[model samples]
Target chain A: AQSVTQLDSQVPVFEEAPVELRCNYSSSVSVYLFWYVQYPNQGLQLLLKYLSGSTLVKGINGFEAEFNKSQTSFHLRKPSVHISDTAEYFCAVSDYGSGNTGKLIFGQGTTLQVKP
Target chain B: DTAVSQTPKYLVTQMGNDKSIKCEQNLGHDTMYWYKQDSKKFLKIMFSYNNKELIINETVPNRFSPKSPDKAHLNLHINSLELGDSAVYFCASSQRTGNEKLFFGSGTQLSVL
Candidate 1:
């Protein structure tokens, strides 16, 4: 079974401040990590995904994440955040094994509230 | 243009009712999926179809059934809806191989009264 855990349910930060949303996963098979953002009343939009190679991956809106294998974690980070960045973020895991169709298991989601 | 679209963006029905949520994707992907986001904001895969063939069922309840008329369309039908059935149902499509990112619809917010 594949599962993802978002440690923080809600994160409040000031504008222009750095922020990190922690995520951890557990899977018997190889897994692909992804960060999806959901604006108010909207569906999830893909932020970035870590498939292979470098441990650090960059995504849209100046966001990035580093995948730590030994720690079993993929934490999302941003050097600076804007008011527009306030939204709900979800950490998801997908089975990367061959012949496996795309089935994404998502975490509970963390609400990022950026204050001016 | 909307890459993926679902009809009846909001659904409010009484308990024990039967309803259906229709989804269509124009991205020309061969695989589509249905996901349910519960009140707690946990997104779970309900079903998946590749080339209009069932690929994953995820042990969803028999009350929930999915139909894929073609690769571009996948519809979900619910029977005997209960209060616990209220959720946001998302329709997504993808290449089914080599890629993991999915194009998702706005979702149907179903509220069973």
Candidate 2:
């Protein structure tokens, strides 16, 4: 079975400050990782994804994540955030063993509150 | 035009009533899925269909049924709803199976009272 765990339930940071949201996963087989963002009263949007290649992946809105295979972790980071960055972030994983069903196991979302 | 869309953005119904949420994707994706988001913001996949064929059915109750009339349309029907059934239901689609990026609908918020 595959599972994802978000270390924080909520994170509060002042605007223009740096932020990191930690995510850890456990899977017996190879996996693909992704980050999604959801704004208030809106659907989720893909932030970035890690399928293969370099461990460091950059995403939209100046967001990036590093995939540490040994650590089994993919943490999202932003050097500076704006008030509009306040939203819910989710970490998800899909394992290759599922036979390409496109089924994703998501972690409990982390609410990012960008204080002004 | 919206890439993915679900009807009845907000649905409020009494317990024991039956309801259905309709979903369609204009992107012409071959796979569609239904996901549930609980109050705690935990998302779980309920059902998935590939080209109108059922591909994945999670450990969800039988009362929840999904139908895909075509490759671009997937609808979810719930019977005898309970208080626990009150959650936001999302419909998503991808270009194909296999770890592809998904486009999600705005979601249908179902409230059982």
Identify the leading candidate in terms of TM-score. Answer: 2
Candidate 2 structure quality by residue, lDDT tens digits, B1-113: 99999999999999999999999999989999999999998999999998899999999999999999999999999999999999999999998877999899999999999
Model 1 spans > 4 angstroms off: B97-99
Clashing pairs in 1: none
The chain B TM-scores of all candidates, as shown, are: 0.96, 0.99
Report the C-alpha lDDT of model 2 over A13-109, residue by residue, as the tens digit: 9999999999999999999999999898778899999999999999999999999999999999999999999999999999877376889999999
**Which DockQ-derived CAPRI band holds candidate 1?**
medium
lDDT score of residue B69 within candidate 2: 90
Interface RMSDs of the predictions, in order, are 1.5, 0.8
Model 1 residue B78 CA deviation in Å: 0.5
Across A8-72, the per-residue lDDT of candidate 1 in tens digits comes to 99999999999999999999888899999999888889999999999999999999999999999
Which residue pairs show backbone clashes in model 2?
none
Using DockQ, give the best candidate's number: 2
My TM-score estimates for the predictions, one after another, are 0.97, 0.99
